[model samples]
Target chain A: MWLAKNKDEREFTGGKTDWEAAARIAEQCSGFEPDDEDEQTADEAVSCYNCRYRRWTVKSFSCLLPT
Target chain B: MEIFVGIDDSRQLDGYKAGETASLLTRAIEDKGWGKSKIPSRHRLYPNPVIGYKKHNTARSFSADIDEQYLNPFITYACTMIKSNVASGCNAGLAVVVPERMVNRDDLISYAYRVKEEQVSKEECMQLAQCPGIYLFELSGDGRGVIGALAAAGLRLTGNDGQFRGKLKLGHEEYYVATVKEIIDKTYVQQVKSMDLVRLEDDETVRMGEKVKVVLLDNLYTLMVFPTDLENPKWQTSTTHMLRMF
Candidate 1:
């Protein structure tokens, strides 16, 4: 899983290091493919404020799709 | 929120009364507030579009009903409702676009809704007026396509980024209202200022930032997501799941 800082984060934090921060902490990492393992990771990562799909209204695993 | 609803004379049949309906709606809003800062605002009354008796159903002469001479008066009423609601310090404007099909119908009806406190141009208003059969709800923002996410639900537009505003109910329990704003970008075609329209593009390949605002009406909670890629199925599925998280 790859990650990028939010818009507000970019403005607040000058470095692009937030991407590495999320990527390093990601349980299962991939290069943008939708797989069952990725889906499970996404499900477990649900409700995580630092997850790629944070602030989501749904519990779908698509949130971890290499974003 | 304070809302001033205007009914066209065409809508004002012998048994239908706009004033009484408005009063009831005000009470409902007030009751929802529970004496908090959410209390409803003061409404300004107005009588627009004089009523004229006209035959509605061609089945019989007795099917005649009262109708409006013009639609402007009803639109004016909606504007007044927004003005009063905003002046009273409500969060946003909520207009109800009623249709003839909604009257005396046994089946449930789905009315269209827009929910911004912004101003719409006269040309857009005219276009909408021509289609009186369609209901409308005006929300804040330039009626442009850039705000597609504001009104995202219940919209079925292809290749356009739309702000998904939510839905509203009208009249009885038979109606539901939803809204979406289409993003309109410009395409320069020589001397022609053509609009280059694109649907909500997927960002599956690239790791871009995303911003999402979700309103859970069932729970009355709003979720805002940011910096997520569009094409990421995880993001999409998660966003959908979060809608019902409460």
Candidate 2:
């Protein structure tokens, strides 16, 4: 699907895709990006704070939220 | 677009009944009514035609709207394929392929509203005093801000109900709406893998020492078997007759 320049409506036709290819296409087709404040707030969220019940916490695991 | 599914048909576990086990499947499909519009046919297994189409952004949510847009023809084709496939003996997982460029409006709006409400509250607005005219920086930001927040959150902001609803149609999924007005109020429950020849009926019972195969379709699990005694006064496991393709 491609939106005409400065237009909200778009056109689309079916095509083949894989996961990686889909991601690349999405990135290219997407027209907007978030502002800095939104990014900072998202970054500040303590996604791992609920993971307090553990004997060990690795750096990689620190980024994971409690299941 | 074309989608291909590889089916291993040579693997057939014989010595079981096919007719006795089909009612459960039919009842399940009837309950979901996913294939109501398609022409019914008999076969072991056939490829679903609805597997490989892209979901464009402007498509409507109502089935009627989709039919007007010519999507229903493909959906009907897919349903018919599934019905035929199940009838014939195709037992395997389905593969669906779709284009990535299409965006779902519901997903995009949902993400956008979430970003506005959660991240950029009114208190965060910064007033520019020295720009010759008054300007609030936050008030003028575009959708890029919302998209960025969604990206950071690992969320796709442009998907509609097409992907979710399409699977339901293909697999004979069941669902109930919890809320009528909300966009996200709908839910799904898969009823059957296909509406072919195998099914479960109300007055059927399976006993131990009888041959049976576990049928797993969507999320429902069932046991299939052929009767041991059709003429004897007392049906015993030892006297049962077995047929192929259960």
Candidate 3:
């Protein structure tokens, strides 16, 4: 699930700890690129929390990939 | 004398990583016969938007046992390396701390925790730098990186924060299973423990996943594991998400 903050910005509705949701969403997203090894935080190899385009926000994280 | 070298680099989105720079510094120290360096660790800083970091807000640092006479030369070389490697439109900071010579070690440790939980400024770091045995430098740009660099040294001194920079490769497959003693023999890991901080016995077995990582715990390279099956009490290496707190 995602919340559209603007024309090109969106945030993950699952917040930071929703590993299953983040992984599910990333699996379908074409722009999901794995971040640096040190930055990745998810056990799943492919997850939004591990995506290079995801920018961490105070409450959750936002997708930086152009929508 | 033993010293900790801390570095933080704020670079372009696609520029070189600060961790790589930290690793290079360790190699340089050995190549120049300056000292024997330990593995560099990555310390996480407060992620507030005010910091304006490119991605994750983190700094890298490592400890070294060196000849006291070479201190100045090492510092000068580090400064030059960081200045040249920093990317355009970015800032980099370097800090060299000798704990034994510090005026008050507690003050630096407290400041380090504050940087992790709250907004810290360059002025605060500058004030702390006045203490003996602590040196801070701003290599490029606006020099905000000094905040993280100083904090990184403090965290490293605590010996409880941060994870080592790279993974521990013990096998060629997706997973590797070994006894606690065997794991220690194959890698730099000095201790193996469960999630609850209970140290596993030498004969205890562990299943290491694809990415085996170690954290700086109790001043040693510690590998943490969780039970794969409570009934059988099988241990497995902690995953990336599990080690995020470090």
Residue B237 in candidate 1, Cα distance off native in Å: 23
Model 2 Cα lDDT, one tens digit per residue, B130-224: 22211111111121111222211111122111111111111122322111112112223212111232443333332323221222223132222
**What is candidate 3's lDDT per residue for B1-246, written digit by digit as tens?**
999888988745667578998999899989999889999999987765664435667888999999999999999999998888888867788999998898799999999889887788788899999999999999899888888899999999999888986678887766677889999998999999888999999988888788878999999999999999843438999988788778
Candidates 2 and 3 compared: the better one by lDDT is: 3
True contacts reproduced, candidate 1: 0.00
- Candidate topping DockQ: 3
Give a tens-digit lDDT track for model 1, residues B17-92.
Answer: 2233334444443354422111111111111111111101000000011124323443454345543433211112
DockQ of each: 0.02, 0.01, 0.57
Summarize candidate 2's per-residue lDDT along A29-54 as a digit string, tens digits.
33322221101111111211111211
The docking quality of candidate 1, as DockQ, is 0.02
Model 1 iRMS (Å) reads 21.5
Model 2's alpha-carbon lDDT is 0.22
The i-RMS of candidate 3 is 1.8
In candidate 1, stretches whose alpha carbon ends up further than 4 angstroms from where it belongs are: A5-67, B1-78, B84-95, B101-129, B135-246
Better of 1 and 3 by DockQ: 3
